[model samples]
Target: MPKAVLALGANQGDPARQLALAGAAIAAHPDIEVLAESSVIVTPPWGKTDQAEFHNAALLIETGLSPLDLLDFCLATEAGIGRVRLEKWGPRVIDIDLIAYDRLEMESERLTLPHPYAHQRDFVLTPLREIAPDIADWLVNRIGTSSA
Candidate 1:
């Protein structure tokens, strides 16, 4: 089973509760097993700074699903929790991002592995550091090696 690193956040409608519910739903998915979860951390908005602060956390999961399948699962979880994509980086009820999928690196119209901007966001890094510090190093290495 591949281990996937995921980031979860919410800035609207009881942020902590939203994260909790998202975590539970993700764990209950047949293809995913929650191996570890980080403590939620409070952080300010990212791209859109006008919104309320967000509660963020990271999850390490063991899964049988492929990367795209996992992305679908994350999207489903978001939609199930009433996520609305009204604006870029706008406040949301919930947000689940696939930060990494094992060591796979690829990008398409649908998704990007290792999440393109994860390294640039403290909100994503702090909780992720708690669960998988090595990922930070991996990301650094990837960044160093990438020509783009």
Candidate 2:
């Protein structure tokens, strides 16, 4: 199995509860094992600043699923939790982001490894730094480089 980092956030319908349910759901997946999780933090809205603040955290997991499969898994988890893509960076019941996957790097229509914006978002990097500091380092080192 390969290790990956997932960032979680929620701004509506009891954000804290949403994160708890999401963590449990992810951990319950057959192809995934939750190795570690971070404490959630409150952050102001990012791209879309008109919404409420968000509760953010990250998780380290060991998974047998491939990158795209894992992405699909997260999306399904979000939908199961009543998430809707009403707006970009808008408020939601839950938001799950695959921050990194076993040092793999690639881009496709549906997903991107080492998420294209992970290097620049404090909300993403803060919790991610908690469970996997090395990944935080990789995100920072990629900054200002061609890949970023």
Clashes of each: 0, 0
Q: What digit string (tens of lDDT, one per residue) describes model 2 on residues 1-148?
A: 8999999999999999999999999999999999999999999989989989999999999999999999999999999999989878888999999989988888899988888888888999998888889889997787537562
Give me the candidate number with maximum lDDT. 2
lDDT of 1: 0.89
TM-score for each prediction? 0.95, 0.96
Question: Candidate 1 on 46-113: residue-level lDDT in tens?
Answer: 88898899999999999999999999989999999999899988989999999999999898999988
Maximum-TM-score candidate: 2
Please list all clashing residue pairs in model 1, or write none if there are none.
none
Worst 10 residues of 2 by lDDT: 139-148
Off by over 4 Å in 1: 144-148
Candidate 1 has a TM-score of: 0.95
